[model samples]
Target: MRFPHVRRGKAEEPPGIVGVARVDLRTKVLVRRLEPGDIAVIDHADLDRVSADELIACRVAAVVNAAKSVTGRYPNLGPRLLLEAGIPLIDDVGAEVLSRIADGATVRLDKDVLYNARDQVLAKGVLMTEETLDAAMEDANAGVPTQIDSFAANTLEFLRRERDMLTHGIDVPRLTTRMLDKHVLVVVRGYRYREDLRALRPYIREYRPVLLAVDAGADALLEAGYRPHVIIGDMDSVSDEALQVGAELVVHAYPDGRAPGMGRLRGLGLDGVSLPAPGTSEDVALLVADACGASLIAVVGTHWTLEEFLDKGRPGMASTFLTHLRVGSKLVNARGVHQLYQSRISGWALAALMIAAAVTIGVAIAYSPTGPILGNWISATWHTFAYWFTGLFK
Candidate 1:
């Protein structure tokens, strides 16, 4: 997709750029309710690629951000992605615009200026373009060293706080799911999650592994026709239908036992056990699988690389790093498994082979010397059964 180079202070009008505005402080939550042709108004700063992808999937006509899409902290790829997808992006519109504009109100965009029905200007923001994005990316790249230093410091602090849990595996929540001596598949809604799951279809069918989903990954599993045996996460992104699918719910809470998600469960009239730990939900899911003594754990779409961690804007990747260390031997990346494993013979092929074998056996028997003896035996048995049947009816 190609985007026009937008010059700053240019007053050129974009053709037919009008739609209902959908406002939300939380981009992720807003994305769930977003519909195609609607203008997304969000307060997200330095929006990540994943969120951008979700918004793109929703097919929003445009995005208006209250905060800077690229703050020069690091090269966040979200704004660039949206622009490249041919979606209009207006940045630094200020948070006050969210309060002034009501949700589902029709708004028109004339270049960078947003107006209500009366043509009154509500907000003005800078239109992002290829030149500006490239410049911002260069600045962001120059700032990576400082970000890395901050990341290291945060990781060290996380390691210090989570040492006991990592080393001893103490305080891991007990689960009723029998993971011991059985394969456990942990699905996370991360990069290429749907593609990874599609590739692992053979593995899923052959092993019949215990399906464990983290947040929206539960919906992914359901879409793939597999019911999650256990659902682990903060319960924010997952749908209510997924929660009511009868899977065991495990809520990830703070170390101090503050579970913000518990209220949602209570509101849903659902029961869940709290797992207090300091880490991402995916990390907690891995820990749960290891703690439950899974023979092998296959992970799908979990972030691994430093860039991926940074893309997620998660400063506590030290916990994920430590969790991997604890579950070292058993954990296997599903992406690797998809590449290496051989495809098993499908059920239809096996059935066809069995039918072919049966036909061959029948042809051989018909031409064999013992064919006459076999026919005589069959005739005698039928006659005897017929006589018995006639006597019973009489």
Candidate 2:
């Protein structure tokens, strides 16, 4: 359904507006007028930071992007899933687009296109989709639309077939390490997963997962008040403090048998072992947990697509090549910890609330503040508190 464009300054929304869904940013920034109920659609500076799978699982119906997603500048998963799910999308809604939108402004997608399950363009024009992306790129690359679609369809089909074979109860060759049976928490380096991690604190603390870091993830996990049992990967992104934190370090080596990260491990006075497989640090991590017989492996900020791989600008993914081989059914992408676990007020929150309430009540009785402005501010604060509390249930 097309949302009627709300001309700036209009308080009344036309029927076209289905309600504002929050915009997330990545390549560009959009600051639109919005209200509390609006979706916080966003794009991160790093595409991998945006969790498309979780977003879909939560079932947002529309998105406005501030980046050139289907423009060949980045991966297609974000736009691809939106289109497939029939979510309306507008691309390149950068800073300019944001400035025009106000909090609670009904966001209208004047141009949204869609594609069907068969990869056929059901609708086209203003919205972003792989078809639009392919056509624009194909035109420049001198390839026909049909040919590109054929290749992509075949590729998607093959991926599905392979996933079925690999994940559907079969055993294959895998890397071995003994930490597999531990409650493993895999960390990815310097991403926007901080909020996700913070929200996951209850689970992490309650379960006490074996904290495993892949380079920078070691530093991140440490900062979050967690200790690393093992730090895996190239050892480049990890901090010296983290290296010194007493976690065992293992260097990942290339297939040619060169362990480049070994030197870094040595410099940190840590002994290392080489896992010469092909993939990202995350890929080898899965192998490590699986090989080690991890009872359950949970991944935070893990990459799941070619777009993410390409966005990293790596040549190939050899380490990840056999990862599905090792941890086929043992993996869990714990992106939405907020959804998986309920936050109980517990005795702590309740006790803290009582103390705060007593202070607020005592101050109000003593001061008897009378200014309308101050009263309004207090009301807004309460309203905002109520909004966030509702999100916990949502």
The candidate that wins on TM-score is 1
- lDDT (10s digit) by residue, model 1, range 198-217: 88888788999999999988
Runs in model 2 deviating more than 4 A are 1-180, 305-307, 318-322, 339-349, 352-394
TM-score of 1: 0.81
Candidate 2 residue-wise lDDT at 143: 31
Error of 2 at 83 (Å): 24
Error of 1 at 380 (Å): 22
Query: How do the residues 1-394 of candidate 2 rate in per-residue lDDT, one tens digit apiece?
Result: 3333347855443332254544434322222123433443454322332444444445555665555544444433455555666656555545444444444444433355322222233223355566775575454334334434544565455455445433432222332334545778888853345766888787787988888888878866877888888888877556778888877777778756688898877776677677665446677677667666788888886665544544453433422434554575777767777666766778898999999998997677657756556668788999999999999998
Candidate 1 lDDT (Cα, 0 to 1) = 0.86
